[model samples]
Target chain A: MSLEVNGHKTYAYTGNHAFDACLPTVIFIHGAANDHSVWALQSRYFAYHGHNVLAVDLPGHGKSAGDALNDVATFADWVKALMDAVGIEQAAIVGHSMGSLIGLETAARYPAIVTRLALVGTAIPMPVTDALLETSAANDHAAYEMINVFAHSPRAQIGGNRLPGAWMMGNSMRLMERSANGVLHADFTACNSYRGGLDAAKKTKCPVLLILGQRDLMTPPRAAKEAAASFSNARTVMLDGTGHSLMSEQPDAVLDALIDFLRPKNVTAA
Target chain B: MPAPKTYQLDTLSLHAGQQPDSEFGARAQPIYFTTSYVFPDTDHAASLFNMERAGHVYSRISNPTNAALEERIAALEGGVGAIATASGQAALHLAIVTLMNAGSHIVASGSLYGGSHNLLAYTLPRFGIETTFVKPRDVDAFRAAIRPETRLLFGETLGNPGLDVLDIPRVSEVAHEAGLPLLVDSTFTTPYLMRPFDLGADLIFHSATKFLGGHGVAIGGLLVDGGKFDWDKSGNFPTLSEPYEGFHGMVFTEESTTAAFLLRARREGIRDFGACMSPINAFQIMQGMETLGPRMQRHMDNTRAVVAFLDKHDAVEQVVYPELPSHPDHELARKLLPNGCGAVFSFELKGGRSAGRKFIESLKVFSHLANVGDAKSLVIHPATTTHYRMDDAALRAAGITEGTVRLSIGIESAEDLLEDLSRALRASQKA
Candidate 1:
């Protein structure tokens, strides 16, 4: 299933039509340097189980064409507009890395529109080294290597060991390389400067899920731990042997956590 | 060490759980790094095992260093007793399991930490336990959700990332009406902003890894028994009133009325689960706790300044902070947290996800990590990060949108933090 969201033709893997109608929709937001295809597993798996899954290409990332952003709030506005466009009055947002930050801001800004939030491989106070930024700017090779080094597990890194994983990495690297440097820099800068959500985290009226990979060097589990601490209603999950790209590296674990969080229970059942 | 009748948090944070070293007279709490404690005699050891006495029998059950942390936190939370665990998750699990059985149920606020939501929504059901989730401030919803089998009512004092204030008293009333205890995860608000016990909570829990250990050095959790719940009155709590084969038929409520839950949690829950906190982590958390009051004050101040800056920014569509009059819960926040809310909030970008990403890229001072409550500022996009797992409907129910950026304000100079945010917002708009 597909529809126009924020002027972009968005695609979604509509889970069981009957289930999708009854169950809440889930929007998958990709991380920096990646496209909607990054959520192939999640979209399909979730859709199959009974969810309305929408995974769109952020403007200028994939099929969506628009000028990149320079301000974090602009992107947040775009998300709000997109939600409006799709007639999705409310949703449970699942974001990874850069997407996680966006999810945080979205829930914080439009508290009425978000039902629940799952921040995967996210952190506040993201630590980005100068070398990483310089390498990403210098060439595609450095950029790919840096992202891979920070995102993949040692086992996944072994040549020819995980062909699909490697292919995904290569494809994501290509997309990121194609993205404008100004946009990338802006994104990093916004991340570096962001300081609004902690208090929001403490007071979020909604349920929040903080997921981190134990081996994630980019945003280690420690960062998730810290964020989880401020959330009285929050819970933290540290996935063993997974890095920042938990969705790609261990989608099953991520899915398990999400399923656990979203399933209706005696308490949550309306 | 003899327990004082009562002490200030500042003093108790340093000395409540420690004694001058018997061998060295060390003024600081020495890490009894060893796993096992020597028994004075066989009868003493047997008595400990038989529940006739209270002492550390094993590391998994208790340790001197961890015990000190448990005591300190108990004192800080104004609880009769406490139990330390390996991690915050473990602490939550222990708390839930200690109170509930296979056929029991829980009434929880919908606004919760994701992990806790999962545990309540999915995992607990696997064990035949059930949960009912309601909006934090929906006192009526809580009352409506409670069942005859509901064993407890749960909520966080301050919700994570989005900063939704919990209406503790109203929910407490609902729980008490159902003859159930209210368990509050006070990790976010800490004791500095609000004390759950004073607000009517029967139990308080903390993920000591964050603000309590402000430096981000340790991972530990504590469960403090308010010593207020009447287990005997509520027949739902069998673990507290019933005899235990594990502890020679001793009933927790009768043996330790003021700390029945804590005693049972320590003796049976942590003991059986084997998720005791590490002595080293406990010691590190203690160090952080020593400065908690001061750190929290700075965090609150920095957060207020940041909120002011964001509220004034043109690109920001909405700023969700309880302190802001614009927030729907502003009045409730004032009544509950007069000292000011903790240091996390969210805002929407004009351009949505792309602009949100670009803004993150443009920042120079703030680090883009997934963690919060550090001495440093942090940022992330929720649409693309934390709430991704939730389907759109759930996201909407939870209030997540694509362009939203969640910020964890730090203890930095508010001016510098505002400048960095300004630059990032400008850069994102331009991009």
Candidate 2:
């Protein structure tokens, strides 16, 4: 569904189900160079299983219309504005990679509105290598190739997607290719330049679930342990043999963990 | 950061899709031969049906064994996903139906396999779809043939026996300019020889019954989605962008950023068409495909030898392989098919139909049959066999003659294949 957020047209996938104001809401945020479709299976599950799902394509990323935000702080503000636009009072925020920082900043800034937080494939003070930034800045195809290689594990680099017939690596590559030329660079800049993650974790008061990939090269699991200490209330679910693309490589495992953590206990007060 | 070290084609062929069974530790891809799977409970069943989860409910929709083949093919083709079908024709049918419905039109190449010609020219039109056929080398002719109703522009990567190499980049330019997708038949030139998607084709299908299967034992096809075409942006395909009434009012493009085409192709076309590949056949094809790299190298080597013998022979009028400088699209073939123009090609005998019969009958080492891409060498007269249904204009456009004899050089000994063709050519001239 298309909604208005800060006057820019925003697209959110509701899993083909309409959002009811009475139900608790779950808003899914995707990582760099991706849209709401990354959460296709998970967001759809939540919508069907009694949550008002709003899997948004962040501004200038996917179907959403606007210029790409320059920093994580702006992205956090955009997420809060999106919820306000949709009349979603308080909701559980689920974010992956770059979006995780946005969720952390949002939770810290607006503790009254954030009921719970689930950080997927996240890290504190996420860093981008100089080589990746150069390639992405030039809008070269090699940057997409580099990220796709590192994002998937050796096991995932091969196959065995629970989703029949889909190739996870190829799909990830194509999704990055689909984004506009400068969107990826802007996203990487947001992640690399952000220093508010640990401070945000300290201020955040909501129950937190940190889902980390055991073999993730992009954000090492060691970072998640450091993040857990900063959060007042947080637990971790480590997916074995998975990579940075945990949502796609270990989709069922990720969803199962989400189902347990964000069970009825964490349902937002609508 | 370290440089990316993704697996190459040979490695992908051997190990791209299959994972050892967690239960019994079966290293080989196990065939899930059953028709249905048991769900853990009712919610799980509903979730599977609703596309809220990713598990197979029925064989026609998907099977673990077939998915191994699909994923492997997708990996090989650099596609987001693929669907395995009963035949090459079924894969072609699945692609067309998924994109458009009644009153749709296609601008296709005149130099197509007869089976493809039959579908686009005859059967599809019966259901209110129409096609305009143009020469594959005539890129402008493709653009000229497109009407307001046209949704697809299609051609073979290497046009059947004629070997008229389709200029994928140029033709795809025309399709993209008109907000359409270019679908190509890569049956003759498999991914081993040419990847159509990398060359700008949006969709590709292979007659796995031939080269991919190699042994001529199993009949199957693979339809791959390159996942590059923007169906949502095109506004030409409401079937993908709009809420599909056929399946829960779900917007397919909203489901997957890149794989919307494959999603709709599998969900609606494969489910309703009922032209699904069996797990056993999928397994058989995978067996041949595992050795695809080495076999293709040998297939190309044997072909070069056969082409050389036939090129200077007294009884041979002309050879239609693209490697020959005399062929019309030799330059284009060199540009596109860097590996080789595949193993299938046709040569005209000095005598006409009688000579075709004589040569076919005289061949000892080569099997006189309609199929190509077998482990054993095979021969056929396209005018009477595989392309029998095409009329004079279609036949001429496809570069076929009464004297034309097509050969699918296999991985067999080149010495034997050369002797067999030389003896057959001498016998053919007697007619």
Candidate 3:
């Protein structure tokens, strides 16, 4: 479904269902150089199992139209505007990598609107290496190669995807390579420049869940210390043998963690 | 300053998708002949069935042995992923059906394998898909043939029978210009001679029964996706870019940006068509791939020697080997196929139909059969064997004649192959 958010066209996958504002809302945000498709299994499962799923392609990514935001704050604001446009009063926001940071900022800035927050493969003060930032700025293909190799674990280098015949490493490389010319550089810059994670974590009152990949080199589990501590009610779950590309590497584990956290028995249907 | 490069082609062929078998510590891949795997519990079963995890549940959908072959081939071809099928024709069918609907059209080179031609001309149209055949050498003809409904532009790496080298760079540019993908049949050249993705082809398929399976013990096909084509940008492939209702509204392009075509091909094509390859066949193909590097080199070496001898012989009317200056695609072959023009080529006998048969009967070492890419040298008279259904006029249009004899050079001693061909040529003249 396409919606007008902040005067730009934003594309969100509605879980193969027409968008209906009546159900409980869950929004999926993707990492840098990625779109809504990264949430393929997770979002579709939720949509089919009684949830209003909105896997949004951030502005200037995937099918959405606009210049990529230069900082996390603008991305957070766009999510809020998208909710207002779609007529959803409250939602559980889930994000990964750069998206996790967006979820952090959104929950902080608009605490009343964000009922629950789940961050996967996340870290506070997400730092970009000078080498990666510089190469990405130059738009070198090597940057893609480096990230593709590092994002995947040794097991992911071979062939095993939820769908048969899908190569995970190759698929990730191609997705990163497809990012609009200046998009990667902008995304990394935004992550590097943002200094609000500690502040956002303190302001966020909603129940938060942090899903960390034990082998994630991009945003190591150790790096999420500050954000985890600041949250009033935050729980961190660490998964072994998975990397930054946790969604594809250990999909079932990640989904199970999220599903368990998001759907609590105490919370009755609205 | 740069990071060290990963494995090369030789190393990738052996190690790309393989890990030491954990249970028995077997070094080589073991064929998992079982049909279904036991899930750990209810949730585990649900996750795998719901596409939340990556593991083999059913042999028909995926098997460990077949996945190893798929990944190894993808690594060799510089592609994102590959699907193993029952045969080359099945691979082609999966690729076409995944991207197109009933009203879709295709622009293909006229020079194609007889089976491929039959599929495009007669079979696919029966299902409502149409194809326009163009001469491989005519670049403008390809451009002019494109209609708004055209979904793909296709040709062979080395055009079958006539080794017309498809100018991949040029044709792929044309395809991208029209927001379409270029699909090539790389059966003849294999990845050793050419990596179609590197040359601009978006998707490639091979008749593994040939070069990839040098022993010719198994019949299988491999369809590889380069994962470079932008299906969403084209806006023409709804089967990929848009939500598909068949699989609970899964939008393939959203599933994996580069691998969407392959995702649908496996989930929908293999599921509905039921033309999956056997695990044993996949294991055999994997064995063939282990020796692909050395075997292809030997096959090319023998071909050059045989082509040189046939060019100088008195009984030969025309030699259609692309490396020779006399052939039309000689220069293109030099530019595109730097390794070699491939092991298979056709040569004409000065005398007519009876001479062709006499030549085949005269050969002792070369097996007269309907298949190629065998360990033993093989020969076939296309006018009588592959293209017998076509009338004389149709055969002429397809660049075949009664005197044309197709030879698939094997990895044998060059001297032996040359002597055998020499005897056949002399016998043909006398007949």
**Better model by TM-score: candidate 2 vs candidate 3:** 2
Global lDDT of each candidate: 0.73, 0.91, 0.87
Candidate closer to the true structure by DockQ (higher is better), 1 or 3: 3
> Against the true chain A, what TM-score does chain A of candidate 2 give?
0.98
Docking class of 1: incorrect
Question: Which fraction of the native contacts appears in each prediction?
Answer: 0.00, 0.78, 0.43
How would you encode candidate 1's per-residue C-alpha lDDT over A1-270 as one tens digit per residue?
A: 345766666544332233244666777787776656566555655555456777766666544566655445667777888878767777788888877777788877888877888888888756566765555545434655567656765433321111110222333333465556555655655566667657657655678888888888888777767678876677888888777777656755776688788765511311
Model 3 C-alpha lDDT per residue in residues B258-367, reported as the tens digit of each score: 78898899889988997889999999998989888899999999999999998888998889998999988889889999999899999988888889889999999999
lDDT of 3 at B416: 92
TM-score of chain B of each: 0.95, 0.97, 0.98
Judging by lDDT against the true structure, name the best candidate.
Answer: 2
Tens digit of per-residue lDDT, candidate 1, span B263-377: 6787779878888888899889988888888888999988988889889999898998989999878999999999988887788888877788898888877778776666678
Shift of residue B396 alpha carbon in model 1, Å? 2.5
Given candidate 3, what's the lDDT at residue B122? 98
Q: How close to the true structure is residue A256 of candidate 3, measured as C-alpha lDDT? A: 82
Name the candidate, 1 or 3, with the larger TM-score value: 3
The order of the candidates by lDDT, greatest first, is 2, 3, 1
lDDT of 2 by residue, A52-79 (tens): 9999999998899998886999999998
DockQ values of all predictions: 0.01, 0.76, 0.40
